[model samples]
Target chain A: MDRVPILKAGDVLLVSIQTDLEDRTVMALREDLAERIVRTGARGVVIDITAVEIVDSFIGQMLAGIAAMSQLLDARTVVVGMRPAVAITLVELGLSLGGVQTALDLETGLRLLGAGPLDGGPSEAQDRR
Target chain B: MTTQPGEQTHIVELLRSRRETALDRWTELAGAELRGRLSRGELRGELDDLLSLMLRALDGPDAEAAHDELTAALSEMSRRRARQAFTPTETAFGVFALKQVVYELVTESGSNRPRLTEELMAFSHTVDELGLLTFETYAATREQVISDQAEQLLELSTPVVKLWEGIVAVPLVGTLDSARTQVVMETLLQTLVDTGSLYAVIDITGVAAVDTEVAQHLMKTIKAARLMGAECVISGIRPQIAQTMVALGIEFGDIVSKASLADALEYLLARSGVRIVREEAG
Candidate 1:
């Protein structure tokens, strides 16, 4: 199983998944993300799936689970770069990721996290935290 | 009744003797029925070719092969007529008219009346088979045309246009069905990804009516777009559609719906932090 790499930028943790996520990989990602959120004391987490082309119910649940877990750790989770097809499939599958924040791309994800573009000042994400 | 070889030759000879007369009479009959939809000369040409083919089929040594060739020719003519929007009656009459011409020629000859009547019956049977074949082909061709038109309409109806740098709009202009809604959803979602548009406005000004099913489809589409991190605004709700939706107890929830496309665009622009100001002309 390939391990998903999690990169830390300032107070945000960025996880750019570049491969097909298997069940074990998702579980590992969830555990690893929870651990890193506490260790780095990050206020935001951005999961970039621009390269992910396929997803199943397991992965959908994992995303919502990650968002919920991060919130408990005093962190906001934003899933970004979701392909239109994937988003549609998730919606059809009755998993809208209701509690998870979404962005169009990594830049927007970072901005949503209030970790990019200081010119816009602190975003609502920062104010809430 | 099967046509005897001797009777077949006799009828073939009679037709060969007066081919021109038979063709002229057949063309006149068919032309009158068509009522100038096809030129007289063009109808004569078609009948001339068919008469020669029929003669060859009766006179040819390989009866089976010649008959198949004649059927193919009839099918080809039927397909052409079908495409020209000729009614099934008009097309079958073109073949059936030949039977009348051959009967006239047989009676005018007046040599072997009894035997000739038997041969005429066989020839009439062949013409009936040919006429029925033409009818079947015409119906099949008409069905093919209808299905092709339906496919074309499906492709032509849905169009996603970029309304602004970060906005796209789908102008729906017909009755909404499941198939069309699926197409609209896919196209709008794909456009959103391609343009990275943060806003989508579904303009339904041209849509004739809205029912619960259409409302459900719209809600599903809006939810899908929102899942992709884009906001969707439903616009151009005519008063009747609004009343119908309310009467049906359809709730749009917190989704921003505006009366006109202009309102939707204005709302999206404001949400995107773009301020529109009036500039005085100097």
Candidate 2:
């Protein structure tokens, strides 16, 4: 029953959560995501799941869905902090993350918010919730 | 029924001037038509032809004539795009329209055997979807170049259970280019807000190359995730990417990097204090 915490960092939005990805967790995330996305008026949003053991199909789809929705709301979204088990299982299942952007960390993902990485790197992090 | 010459002419003028709206409209509508045709078989013959042309272009020397033709078509389409306005769905349909046209032509020609008059029909059935997809036409194809990338991606990526909602894991397996990165960026953000997961993980172990663009994209995702109160975890740090980062003089602070998925899982398990029995070899 661990819930993910949503935060607004400087020029970026952060969503941090511990493992155990279930339906309630997902429902919590989806509530009013659009307004928060546009409120930033900045550029990017990062979803950090550094601590998660089991990321099933539902969670995967929901993440993808969130990323998709974020784009329309005027902000870029990145899915960071994936463990090996989740990566392997997602791949084996033939899941297509057709439209979601992904990165290794929050800092790197935020830099992605720039105009398509055309201006090189400004600088960047991993912190657990 | 709604083709407007005067309006289209104005759009043509706008496209020549590099108007974003007009260009987007033309691409969307045309692209949508291509999509429908490819999915429904209206442009089957054209699809086959285009695929073979792509193959020929790749295998042999450059097909300047074909290149010119494609460029002209794309340019013409852009002019059209500049003339019309489309919703997201319509724009998607337009992109699909263009996609189907090229796919139908390329695939059809690749499979058809000129020597087999007796089995013309049989050849038709066997070779339609058998050829390789190129990046020249579809930008997404370029991102899928790594031999096992997509195969690996499918397994590692979380399924779209909620379509536009949920925690999705994307294990980036290959090079990240501008075109592919754009798609990834948009999709991930939209997905995040829709599903609103606080945790979205991106594992990049199989990526063969990482440039400034890739690193920056990672940054962008992190930025966007934060706005929605989501946490982004990066698990894979291949030796090469690290090397590339150093070479590029990029600085990543406290970025999560695990040697493998098992290591990452252990980290996650530790967080939740959920212990499972590991098989002990006798």
Candidate 3:
């Protein structure tokens, strides 16, 4: 059973989905993320899906679902690193992910999460807090 | 009994002697058919070339030997005529006229009726074969010209220009077909990558009309550009096109569209934080 890892950094939880997300994985990810958000008391979530190429309506709905669910759990969701092709596919599929926030990359995502841009390289990430 | 071999040589002999007279008569007949569409000198020169080519083709050891030469010469003549705007019928007349000349010469000769009939039949067959070759080459040449023009038009219609540092504009003219859409997509995508532009504006001012299919193609193109991380704005929405869209019940959701290229450019410039300040005349 492969599950997307959710890493906690202070109040923000980082999710980088590097694999082609299957239906079951997406469902499991949604459940696992919600539980973690409640248990760890994380306030912000950044999902990096740059490696995703083809995004059908199903994946699109799942993304929006996750965003909406995370919001209910009191965590702000910002979807980051959506590849140009995936964005095009999502638009073509007529699923705009309206409620989901987006950023160009993970750094921008973290910045939008109220941490400012990564200043001292990746190693010193979230350490000041 | 004269075999096919002996009959071929005999006809070639008769044509060789009366070649000039035959050419003069054939040229007159061809000129009449063409109705002086081309200049007299050019017409005469082309006829002269055809006469010599036909003679050379016929000069080989056997009638079958002339087949290759006749094909080569006719191919060149047909291609030239096609470029010169000669009709297929007029070009074929170039070969057909010579057949009539040979027929007249064979009739006027005091030879036996049976030999004359044999020579006339063989001459007609050879001329018919040449005529067929001419038409084939003419059709091929014309098709080549048409397709070349189409390719040139496609290339000319889609011109991607870099409007700003992070913006490019494609002004589309004429109708949008699937083939043209593919070309537009490839060019826009390539331009996006090359320039690393974050915005692209597709202006359809010159497009005469838009249908559901065209709208779909536009959607795909815009979406593809968006996927490349570039914001796409469609411009040049005429009153009639807007009416048609409403009538067709087509809605382009969330896609930014403007009334003109200027407006689209202005919107992009605003988004990119580019300010255009007019300089004072010094």
Worst 10 residues of 1 chain B by lDDT: B1-10
List ranges where model 2 is wrong by over 4 Å.
Answer: A1-129, B1-167, B272-282
Model 1, B207-279: lDDT tens digits are 9999999998998898888877888999999999999999999999988899999999999888887789999
For candidate 3, the per-residue lDDT at B195 reads 68
Worst 10 residues of 3 chain B by lDDT: B1-10
| Whole-model lDDT, model 2 | 0.52
Clashes of 1: 0
Candidates in order have lDDT scores of: 0.86, 0.52, 0.79
Cα displacement (Å) at residue A4, model 3? 11
Q: Summarize candidate 2's per-residue lDDT along B32-68 as a digit string, tens digits.
A: 4443323324233333444344333323245555544
Candidate order, DockQ descending:
1, 3, 2
- Best-fitting candidate, scored by TM-score: 1
C-alpha lDDT (0 to 100) for residue B188 of candidate 3: 85
lDDT of 3 at A114: 75
Model 1 CA lDDT for position B143: 94
The 10 consecutive residues of candidate 1 chain A with the worst lDDT sum are A120-129
Instruction: Give a tens-digit lDDT track for model 1, residues A23-129.
Output: 89999999999999999999999999989999999899999999999999999999988887888788789898989998887777777777774553565434311
Could you list the CA RMSD of all candidates, in the order they appear? 3.7, 24.8, 5.9
**TM-score of model number 3:** 0.73
